[model samples]
Target: MEDLDVVAWIQVSDGRMLAVRSRGRDLLYLPGGKREPGEDDWSALSREVREELDLELDEATFRELGVVRAPAHDQPRHAHVRMACFTAAYRGAMAATGEVDEYRYVGRRERHLLAPAAQAALDLADRHGLLA
Candidate 1:
């Protein structure tokens, strides 16, 4: 089995986390994407968030939220995704950009509408007393 390495942003306001849906996809997810070769977590996540949200992530304010290993969607059955999630301060207005077409804030109860990795991330948040 192979692991898909991904980075995700977990921005919560009033107990709801930021969620996004990419173009041509049905599942909603947290901001961020697969990490490219040679990129550290900060750089990779920053690049992804910039592309998806048109906002610049402040590396200095990054705080790891959690990591989740979940079944990979649209991949081989044996493949899984390891998503490292974080919370960070950012600059610029938040807008759906690049591959992202929709953005919303979601609570734990909305987990059923999220992608697998995002669902796990939200579970982690709830475990940490973040959403409740």
Candidate 2:
């Protein structure tokens, strides 16, 4: 088994966060993907968001949310994932770009719908008052 390192874009609006359902996964997660080797955080995030949601994020609007360590999706508990999460502003319409099957904006009340790691990250954003 190979370990996967992922970078996620956390889009917040009106105290809500964005999550997307993967093509074959049951649980929804933050919109992101595994980073390509040698790619920096900003580059990977931009590419992943474009690939997953067809949204291009403005680099200038990017804000570092935080990192979270949790069990890898569909993987064993011992296998952990280190997610480097970020928040950014975009001007395009939000839609699934085939990589994702569906999209949803999760507010604090709906945070339970997110995966544990994603929920933790969301909590951090809430504490910081980043969800505007």
Candidate 3:
């Protein structure tokens, strides 16, 4: 089985975390993407955020969030994925690039628009007093 390694940015602002929805995908996902070869977590996340949202990651404000491993929700069961998540500050306008069609800040809800892993990150953010 092939492995996919990615880094996600958990961005919280105004008591909500950022979530992105692709044009046809039902589930919202944290803003991130796959890492390039030889890139570390921070570098990969920075690149992804820039590519996806046209924003620059504030490295000085970055923090290491925990990682998540699960079967690739979009791929076959034989394909597993590992996510190295992080939190950072950004100072630019938001735009949907790559696969993202829309973006919004999500708060606590009985049902999340995001996937399980993204929901888990929201849970963590809530526990950290970052969510409404």
lDDT of 2 by residue, 14-115 (tens): 678888988888777988877788998999989888888888899998978788877676656337777888988886887898669999888888776777
Which portions of model 1 show Cα errors greater than 4 Å? Answer: 76-78
TM-score of decoy 1? 0.93
Stretches of candidate 3 exceeding 4 Å from the true structure: 1-3, 77-80
Cα lDDT for residue 95, model 2? 82
- Number of the candidate with higher TM-score, 2 or 3: 2
Clashes in predicted model 1 = 0
Q: State the displacement of the C-alpha of residue 37, model 2, in Å, after optimal TM-score superposition.
A: 1.5
Instruction: Kindly list the per-residue Cα lDDT of model 3 for residues 21-53, writing each as its tens digit.
Output: 866788888888787889888888898898889
Scored against the true structure, residue 124 in model 1 reaches a CA lDDT of 86
Q: TM-score for every candidate vs. truth?
A: 0.93, 0.88, 0.87
Least accurate stretch of 10 residues (summed lDDT) in model 2?
71-80
lDDT of 1 at 100: 95
Q: Candidate 2's error at 85, in angstroms?
A: 1.1
